[model samples]
Target: MAVRAVRGAVQVDRDDPDVIFDETCSLVLEVIRRNDLALDDIISIFFTMTPDLASGFPAAAARAVGLTDVPMLCATEIGVPNSMERVVRLLAHIQTDRPPAMVEHVYLRGAVKLRPDLVRERRPGTRGPGGSTATG
Candidate 1:
């Protein structure tokens, strides 16, 4: 299997622990669902929270949903003037036969504007800049 990277983000209305945990889990699960990935296929996940979100660790939410053995990390997103607030983001590495072109990157809730260009929903047959194969 080839290693592929999946990216996603979600916006949280508040920094409350419950909200953060819920949103983080939802984001991770959606990524897995869209990519048709099993837990075993995930190599690791790196998460980040906008500086405004400080109530909890997004990685905890990941572990709560059966990624206990997978390596994960959490860090604060750099603070930029007027940047989107209270957002959680993740980059997951997975084993897959799909090429980057077929990979679907997700941006949900208020975070959609974070990466308008990468937010398109891509199905298995989709062709992106990476093109038709996993050659990269």
Candidate 2:
């Protein structure tokens, strides 16, 4: 009955709906799959995209991936100095019996560079720098 939070990010190919939707969908799916989360286990999701990306709502990507009833929100990322462009980020609150240490966060595509340590898909039973247990 523990609530765990999973974070993930992916880079959009462009401002086109097709690129944004497809990449966002793939990222959300991975975040769910990597954590072995049930649809109902999800509590809410927070999404943010760089100012340059505005072709679609990333929440729609959640719906496209079958998250019909989950509460989701989207916002614009703050423009920072020398920041990466076309990036979309997501924070998912999920319920699970697993401890927080067992959760695996995701960062894909260009976003992978943001957290290279967590981006690589390694085998299960690995221990990350945070001392958290990881799987994919």
Candidate 3:
């Protein structure tokens, strides 16, 4: 099996903990759904968010959705001037039989603007993140 990294991000409307948790859950669920991944396929997940989203940790929100035993961490993104705000991003590593080119990358809500090229080029046989050819 190959280890593939699935990239995903979602922008929350505000800094409230509840909103953070809810949006994060949505992001994670969407990633899993789009990739057709099972729980055991996940190896670890790394979450990062803009410095402004301090109300909660995305890792904790992931745990609330049955990722409790998986290794996970949360970090703050570098505060670049005028960069996007309230965005929670995740890099989930998973064991898959699929080739590198078949992995899917997800971007939802406002975060979709971050990678307009991927959103626009997401049709079958297009390239996903890292220039991997996406079959989905």
CA lDDT of every candidate = 0.84, 0.84, 0.84
lDDT of 1: 0.84
Candidate 1 minimal-lDDT segment of 10 residues: 127-136
Question: Residue-wise lDDT of candidate 2 within 1-136, one digit each (tens)?
Answer: 9888988898877899888898888888877777888889999999999999988999998998999999999999999978999999999999988887788888877787788866554567853322246665
lDDT of 3 by residue, 35-63 (tens): 78888889999999999999998988889
How far in Å is the alpha carbon of 60 misplaced in model 2? 0.7
Residue 56's lDDT in candidate 3: 94
Clashing pairs in 1: none
lDDT score at residue 7, model 2, on the 0-100 scale: 88
Assess candidate 2 and give its lDDT: 0.84
User: Worst 10-residue stretch by lDDT in candidate 2?
Assistant: 126-135
Which of the predicted structures, 1 or 3, would earn the higher TM-score when compared with the native?
A: 1
Which whole-number lDDT from 0 to 100 does residue 6 have in model 3?
90
Per-model TM values vs. the true structure = 0.86, 0.86, 0.85
State the displacement of the C-alpha of residue 121, model 2, in Å, after optimal TM-score superposition. 4.0
